[model samples]
Target: MIQQVFSIVVPLFVIAAVGYFYGSRVRPEMRITNQLIMDVFMPALIFHVMIQEDFYPSQYLPIMLAGVLLMLGSGVIAFGLARLIHLPWRGFVPPAMFSNWANLGLPLYVFSLGDAALGAGVMLVVAGNILCFTIGTYIYSGKLSSLEVLKTPVIVAVILGGAFNFLDIRLPLAFDKSVEMLGQIAIPLMLFSLGVRLTRASWKDSRAGVIMAMFCPMVGVALALLLIELIPMSAMHQNILILFGALPPAVVNFILAEQYQTEPDAVASMVLIGNFFAVISLPVVLFFVLSN
Candidate 1:
């Protein structure tokens, strides 16, 4: 397990580190590349994942409940904590609620569990996406937009991808080939872009806020593990859920923060803080859960 995790995390991180270095060396270029990855490359990748996987809707019911409950529970708990700390509504909600479902969870699902697990994980992401675009956006921006929710990339990806998968409809060979090529770029590009994005973040700034952000995910980790144990999930799926809960704040949070005029910097800081802690926190949490 140790080696498996190391192998999975090491290369992506190494590449991301290199990307950070290059991004630092070339600022504007990196920004453009980040935008491109987020805007175009990522959507293609998501579409591919959505379309290719065979989703088992019945098997996913409990997992879906777990995901949604964690989101809502964590959101309220984190929001309360943030409020206690006197964080503004803008800064308070994003880190508190957003689980790093994208940059972290998806890849970990692919690596740790393989195809079927990845399919289940995709369902989880789809649910997360709906919450993010609709409720999450409202919480962050202090405004409502049903139209934007329907238009969100992740939502669209889920709906369209499900349609394609269920209908057994295949894309044209040419378009499928194109999407595959572009989709392959998603992980590397996003990780690199994340690295580039981190360049502007001060690792030391917002220490208190960062610490506070870690608190909720810890609670979430405990809750998730307990639920897995009590709820009768398969051992492997339980492991996945525990790890998913252990994941750092969602990258989507920071993106939404920027999009909706939330506290982008604070959200970024929470991600940085949560990720730093995750290296130690996840393994220990996993050890405990698995041992149990």
Candidate 2:
């Protein structure tokens, strides 16, 4: 079991560490690289998984619904906590709601559960992406724009991918292989970019960041446990949801915070602190998840 956990976890952090070391030295600009991952690679990953021969939305509908509820429920909990703690909801709630589904989720699922769970993992990511862009944007900006949501490349990928799946359409083998090759770049890039981002994060708000780091996963796992009881799902789905709940805040939360000028420092603190904590939190979650 120890070996299993190490095999699954070490490689990922090692890659991120590489980026961290490089970032500390060179401080590379990743704006365009990040845009390419979001615009090109991530969408390809989503579309490829969605259009897989074995992919079936109906089989995972309950898990998808649970994923949506988990996000909303986490937001409500975070909002209440923010009020209780006298913190700004803009900074606290989004981190609580959005997790590192892309950076951590896809690889974690593939590593822990094997490639069989990849489709389900991607499905959860697609659902989270929709909420992140639509409701998540509204929470940050106070305006919900369907047009804006639709314009997001990941969202568009979900739409087109789902359409292809539902319509029983398949890309040519050559085209599919090309897209898959492109999609393969996204996960490593996400981890490396995450490492670079962490290098730039300020530790001035460490107190709030530490509090949020502890709070977010607790809220998420508690909700996941409750939902697991209420919702009937396969064991694999249950495990996926549980792991999803325990993941650190999405780096995008910091990005959005910076974009909106809504206490970006605090948000960055939460993101960095939460992820650092994940070094402990994730393995603990994996112990239970893999043990079962």
lDDT tens string, model 1, 164-277? 878878889899889979977876676666677667654544764566456755877877877876676676677778777887776667667778767777777777676666
The best candidate by TM-score is: 2
Q: In candidate 1, which residue pairs clash?
A: 99-250, 100-249, 100-250
Cα error of candidate 1 at position 43, Å: 3.2
For candidate 2, the per-residue lDDT at 252 reads: 91
| Cα RMSD (angstroms) for every candidate in the order listed | 2.8, 1.1
TM per candidate: 0.85, 0.97
Best by lDDT: 2
Once fitted onto the true fold, the runs of candidate 2 whose alpha carbons sit more than 4 angstroms away are none
lDDT per residue (tens digit) for residues 54-167 in model 2: 888799899999999999999998899889988998888989989999898888888899888888888888888888888888878887886877888988898898899999
